[model samples]
Target chain A: MVGIVVVSHSERAAEGISEIAAEMAGDTRIEPVGGDGQGGIGTVPDAIEAAIDAAAGGDEGGDAGDLDPVVVLVDLGSAVMNADVAVELSDAEATIADAPVLEGAVNAAVAATDPSATVESVREQAEAARDVDKL
Target chain B: MTEDGAAAVAAVAAVAERIEAERDHLTELDSAIGDADHGGNMARGWAAAAEAARDLDDPDTGTVAKTVGKTLMSEVGGASGPLFGGSLVFAAAELDGGVDAETAVAFAETYLEKVEDRGDARVGDQTMVDALTPAVHTFKKSIETDDLPPIEALAKAVDAAERGVAFTVPIRARKGRASYLGWRSVGHQDPGATSTLFILEELLAVAADRLGVDAPETDATSPTIPDEDPDEGASEDD
Candidate 1:
């Protein structure tokens, strides 16, 4: 029931990762929220807040309890800053983790869909990706 | 913390602090070939995640992962946010309320597959995949060997990740923002790779701390935030 929101400079990239995660997860409830960094617009706190809200099922007027914890994924600098502020301002319970944009996105998406997923597990997966020699 | 949740919550807290400490260096690396906001982005994401985790009176691993993942996805913008966010989500799923060598291995494998499918990049693509793929494989191998405990397995994985990041120095980038630079992307360490290394280093530090092997040195330079009484923020907005 954990919801995942993938924020990126490009909407396509977020959508791409979300699609794959949905495919892998099957019936699990994984929600993908895409924020287009459109011409630098994505870095705005308001935009990021909207994205998180949408991802949390807030946009549809779902009850907060029905709303699972929201996980926000982002791409670049100000976007990170703005997203941070946005989460602080919003009423929804949320958390953020660092993920390398290129590799961690898919892992995060898949992780978001699991019923028993936790922040520690997701961070471990992200950290584990740092090892290249084992691959 | 629940029996299965303690390790993960501790892990998230440890890594968030480490990432905050390393934020500037990450941005500097990104500045060389890409948008130059990697550190800022990662820092912002972790700060949000940390804050979210802190807000919980008593949090389970699932709650912590979802909170962190959502913050990263919403707060950080760029390719990194979603990618890193996805990794956490996948790891959480694999844990399934349990933390063990088998679950850890499963988390790694799931992470690798997600990266490949989403990024449209492979092992040799000169992306973070270079670091991630090797770490996952090594973790799996270590689990099979049974020669090391989870901490040791993580340590080995961290070493492999660093090596993988180093390998990116010579390869021409064939994916992500760096790909446009072609040969120019060589020589300079990939920002994604460098951050990936930091993530592993933080994880290892946390594991060691939990296992009582060695405690992480406190950061003397960080400005301390005075804790606001929880009573002041207890009102539910809804």
Candidate 2:
């Protein structure tokens, strides 16, 4: 199973989106990292890095299957930047999806939770959210 | 050269003070073109950076630079945070020791490379690259001249960054939230560019102060404003 990480500039937004998205996550790990550590409006790269680690099961050091491939969905401008930095800082294999935050997280969660999901497939599913018609 | 990281620490502290002083002005600039959070974000970020630097235990230049990068990454939200943080991270990697002419040049080159790579922004993108690109070039060129001292090279870089900020006022933004504004983004100084200029000015000021070199004031002479045709790049060629 692929893992999913959600990054938002607001703590509530990241956590709430992750919670909503987790409904479709099944066994997939979905980690939410957001805001400055001080409960302010800003993305923190360190928090994102920790999320990536947890999502990838790096903290557990379990079987190879536990270290699932990770895909990150980011909200807005700085979230993308901070996520990129987080990915660079972390040792896990991760990719950032360029898609709408909420929609992408939901779609990615669904895709990633599938038993056959790969990192690329999960990312593609998330990116495909851009075409979702909300009208 | 013997000082491990004190010079870099002081430079970052100066940057924090400068950002605090100009926070309102930067936010005002962003209000015209962005979400109006640039000033607050930068002020918080730099203050965190200064605080982070203060906690370092007998740090090296690399350590100070890396701490600043990490602090900004964790404190500043939005595009500027990552862009600036990533730049500093790479710049720290480029530092051999204390910040001198060579270290500054290396830091500039690496920082610009990381920022451009992260943001996919070009010289005329009306982002921080607009300011950093020219500043790095001027710093490198001045250092290479040999006639100019380290402080003079730094001054030239600061001047170039300020000019870059002015250049942002005339061009429509092509990146970030301001890009959504299209032509409306023109005539407003980009908050990111202004902040970049402030950072460069502070770095130069710190270096001059520590080295006992008389630094040139940033506002001593204004840079030449380019012609006012807004769509020069867009209409350059068919």
Identify the candidate with maximal lDDT: 2
**lDDT (Cα, tens digit) per residue for candidate 2, span A39-115:** 67777788898999899988777764557679999987777878888888887889999999899999999898677
What value of lDDT does candidate 1 attain over all alpha carbons?
0.67
Q: Considering summed lDDT, which 10 consecutive residues are worst modelled in model 2 chain B?
A: B218-227
Model 1, A12-49: lDDT tens digits are: 67667667666765543444433444444454455656
Task: Label model 1 with its docking quality class.
Answer: incorrect
State the weakest 10-residue window (summed lDDT) of model 1 chain B: B218-227
Ten-residue region with minimum lDDT total, candidate 1 chain A: A28-37
lDDT for each residue of candidate 1 in B1-238, tens digit (9 for 90 to 100): 5744566567667777887888888888788778788888888888888787777767676667767776776666666765677556655577665667777778778877866655667877788899998777777776676556777667767777877898888888888778889889888778887778887888788778667796332222111211235444455443
Error of 1 at A38 (Å): 12
TM-score of each: 0.61, 0.86
Best by DockQ: 2
